[model samples]
Target: MRTKPIRALATLAAMITISSTALLTGAADTHAADVHAEGTHAADIHTAAPPGLESLVDTAVTGYLKDDRIPGAAVTVVSGGKPVLTKGYGVADVRTRAPVDADRTGFFLGSLAKLFTAQSASQLVTEGRIDARADVNDHLREATVPDTRPGRPVTLDHLLTHTAGFDSDLVGRNKASAEDVEPLAEGLTTRRPPRVRAPGQVAAYDNYGYALAGQLVADVSGQDFPAYVDTRILRPLGMTHSTFAQPRPPRIAGQQARGYRPDGASGWTEAKGQYGSWSPAGPGAVSTAGDMGRWLTDQLTADSAANRLMRQVHYRQDPRLPGLGYGYEEWRRDGRTGWFKDGDIPGFHSTLLLLPAHDLGVFVVFNGDGTDGRAAVDGRNLIDRVVDHLVPARPATPEAPRPSADPALATYTGSYRAARVSRSSLMAVEGLVGAVTVEKDGDTGLRTTGLSVDPQHGEQRWTALGDGLFRERGAGGATLAFTGDGLLVSSATPATAYERLTWRQSPALHTALLGFGLAVAALGAIAYPATAAARHLRRRDPHPRAARAARAAAAVTGLLAVTFAASLAAVVSDANAMMEAVPLGSPLLTAVTVTGTALVVTTLGVATGAMAAWQRGWWNRTARVLFTLTALGCLALASMLLLYHLVTAPLTWITG
Candidate 1:
């Protein structure tokens, strides 16, 4: 099995934030006004047509669906507080051949549900029920966020802006059914992730932080989190087709667009949807395009206290941009400001963008997970294309200071790790090996490698933008600035920051160490069988019992290596399949877990037998030394696996 990059659904949401920067690209001049056609939804309002908007949108969406082989999607565009276009493309149910209905179809909102949670929290603040800056623990009844830093309590503001400093943990939280889902308080307590940083100091996109916020909402509002959201936000906005319920409400239960994954050459396979115990933290919302349109419209035009509070800029992750404020991620360029939120889970992807300056909003939902080469149909990119068509970029402003070879630049040359990283599992290995290296480029420019996942094209050039800020040469409108606090900030996604690290803690060093260790283990495992066979052929066997024990150790060590390789292959080859299987229980997981346990036991046995052989002096020095080394190596390998959670018992409730 090839090692596939297995990302939890929570990680998928964080990835969306990184990818959203690409949405600002494309040529302008295509206006939504041109696509002025009323949708099937009775509430849709139409205005003057801009002539070519409809065709432009249709062409883009149709091409995306076909190219990516996505089964279905729904898009709603709102201009001047009215929905100008609401449309659905392709089948909602592949099995039933049901056509997607923009007004009726409910797609999982994924992390976008965080927007509602944020709104709920903000609403409480507006109603004087909760203070944005108050300690979150004051309102919690079921769980408590321990104070990692004295005098700095995790606040509603911190949670809203994703600066609560919680370490990322999704294991055993993404439950596939209501039965598996735990109550918000119990769930948070059970999977209570540690705060890795001081609250309000660093921005780390956290689903658990939002989950805590939901619990706060439930406690303060005296209503269930979902009920409060529905009554206060959804229903009040006339979003009747939307529900935050996990198993889904009866009214919209049958209307769900089944999530899908690519089935190799055989076409699409329906994916079992996931429900998290921290559903309110992110995920577990079902909504339609029409309902989303209404929600967007209210966001754009409503004067409600909660709506007003949601729009307020609370914390800016990037000093160069407006950054993340409250429930929405905000961006400003060329005098225009926009707020957006994106969501991604196993089988569903959604994005909501509101351009308050233009009084325009766009919502997109894809039923199929983009793992099947359909990532190009990104909701952010889709919205960006539409935005460009309607409100094109203004002329470029005067350039900032040119790059200069300042000797002081050496201070910036180092490795930086993403502020948000996987903790408490083997996934931490990724963070360990994924640091970005900044090196001085020709004269004035700097080159950054490993900032992106693409190893072949990882290097990005940056020219100084004054004030310790460096702007990417060809990033269009993106920028990266070095903060006084030894952090790197990106204008594109202000919700995430990167922390600079010392040489010893660099990703390059850790990656090299891991590679070297693995290589030695592989060589030893391979040489064991070859050496044994050669010895047997030569009839040189001595101390038969010890030899047999050595051979058994070698075989078990080889099996461990093979198991690790297979696990990685399973992840790389079909991550979605692996994700679906892990939460539901699968034979593959059983095999790997059982084999891993055996490897641990066998390794220990080898270590004990090798000690006995060394004490008894039953073999030649070379044979005893080799056996001792092999035993030690096996133990080390097993220990590494155990430390990384590789050999842990299979988790039936965790979904990637």
Candidate 2:
């Protein structure tokens, strides 16, 4: 680890802090903007013709949409609080062939819902009801931090900043987020608690935390979170079409664009499935581009009190990244100082950008295609170019000092075991002391080096909470506690406590697991001989049903073969953890182990049934047993390889 000291500078000392998202942390996922050019010429506002600007914008937007094969787009340009251009192109619904127009009802905003989160949060701040710096534990009702660690409490500021130290999984739990989108009670409790960095520390993006914030809004405002937004921010701005519609809205329900993966992967089969309860966190909101344009106009006018609230940059931000602050439902980016958000789901993608300084904004929606190919980035860039043509740039702000490293935190570092029962445990060992390297999966570990000892998150001692529960300060991020019977707990979620097992990697345990997998596979393979004998008998009888069964078996076998091949490849070439490594190595360990075993078990069961059916044939029974064993052998190899990958591979690197 580097030993250089990072002394905070006076000019841009606080600005050097790490960031989760370019905007506020709890805000929704959206696109990022780039550097702005300084404006030289001025005073063209009164002219009938904006001088090459309209043609350039129209050409850029039209060309991009046509080239990208976008289904529909809503382009609106607001110049100095006046609607200069508002037009819709193409169709919102391709199946029904409905053309998207200015009044094209409702549309899902994807992660753009984060902007509303910020807005809702800012309203609380405006009323002096919630302090941003106060610990969030104080505000939360259904869920609370079990034991508040020393230093500052996990404040609203921390949650807003995404420096609260929760892992990304805290947000990505599909079931929980979807469930949370239900009425607040069901939706709020579904989320797994977070464990990563501590509150008010380095940045870690958390979408789930924002969901929690929405719940907090409900708790504080004495109104539903979405309703409050409509009353406070939306109603004031005349954003009539926009609503924090729970689950979904009826207006755009039929026209809503479906979400998709990178390919034609069979994930989302419908335009609208369940986003779970956390839907309010993101799924609840719906709006049209024309309405969004009105919202943007409200934000950039600067004359309205709401717009002033939107432009105030609360966080000390770096100029390089645009819109990196948490204000009253507003954020700044690229020195142009604007408000923006984007939404994405299977077949639909939407973006809304509002540049306050230039009174220019744009909204786009593309539906039907389910692939995130060239169009996503190109579409975003095209919007920026439109804004660039209209907005004037300010002087370049002073850049923050180069960040440096801290070395002391390297002391408390080692592998910790986390059972499915408790939070994971960390043992401070000397050899691996340079970096606090924890395996995210068996193959890959997230290494954080050069940490300083702070009394808040990191002190020099470990305190036992009770019942084998222990809490350590110097560890950072996770809590170490004892629960019962020589077992230690180390999980982040309070709802589900995980205990650490002493026998993490005993040779005997591994051998037993491997043996179990082999046995199951063997058992299944053994049925093949009996199956063949049964087939022969059925063939003699000329049973059409038997023929159908044979075909089904063939198809299943083919599919299983493909699965086995993929599993084999993973076992051989992929690292121990195909994704992130958990304490047991890779989650694939469980998948392969269980799936292989199940296959073997099913084969064995079939073979036994076959034996009962053809009691007269010795060769049939023998062949069945042998075949079952062979299949088991194949599965055994795959299972062992899966284990090896979980234990000895690198991170899947999906995010990077």
RMSD of each: 7.4, 16.2
Please give each candidate's TM-score: 0.85, 0.54
Best by lDDT: 1
Off by over 4 Å in 1: 1-45, 147-150, 333-335, 371-373, 399-406, 432-434, 449-459, 523-526, 529-541, 544-551, 578-643, 649-656
lDDT of 1 by residue, 1-656 (tens): 00112433223222211111111112222221221222212223355435566676677766666666566788888887788888787767766667678889988887888888988888889889898898988888878887668888989899989898887755445666656666778888977777777888888778888888999999998998889998988888889889987667787887888877666543666666367767776657788999998888888888888877788788876556557877688865444578877776767778888888788888888877644434423665687778888887776656645655555577788988777765554345446546667888766668887664222355788887566777678635557778878988776657778889887766555444434434444555677678778878999867667657666676666656566555444443455555455434444545545565667677777788778877888578897787777776666656544544555554211311
What are the lDDT figures for the candidates, one per model? 0.68, 0.43
Candidate 1 minimal-lDDT segment of 10 residues: 16-25
